[model samples]
Target: MGNYKWHPRFLNPPRYRKENSQLNIHLWNIMKARVSTNVEKVYERLRVIVS
Candidate 1:
């Protein structure tokens, strides 16, 4: 087995800012579609978990 070095800062780094922004945009689009279709339960559950 290989030894692994764990760095606290690297473990949960905020280095994916760009990717996160794109993902938020995609999530907004999905939420909008679900709201328009009156299927908000799924989005509500996700919001609870995210918040």
Candidate 2:
């Protein structure tokens, strides 16, 4: 996700932007769930991202 969102990488525009603080904070929250090492929590994060 980070790779494609960066310069000279994606073939299309990123769905969200780092310049937008909301998106940055959202991404941070999603990534934070990884530390818990639980599939259910990760799925919940994906749900948050999608909706």
Best by TM-score: 1
- lDDT at position 49, candidate 1: 100
Q: What pairs collide in candidate 1?
A: none
lDDT of 1 at 8: 51
- How would you encode candidate 1's per-residue C-alpha lDDT over 1-51 as one tens digit per residue? 233324554335567687775875687689788787776677788899999
Per-residue error (Å), model 2, residue 50? 38
Candidate 2 vs. true structure, TM-score = 0.33
Tens digit of per-residue lDDT, candidate 2, span 1-51: 657655543423456465675766667678877666688888899999999
Candidate 1, residue 21: lDDT: 58
How does each model score on TM-score?
Answer: 0.41, 0.33
RMSD (CA, angstroms), candidate 1: 11.3
Q: Each candidate's root-mean-square deviation in Å?
A: 11.3, 12.0
| lDDT assessment of candidate 1 | 0.67
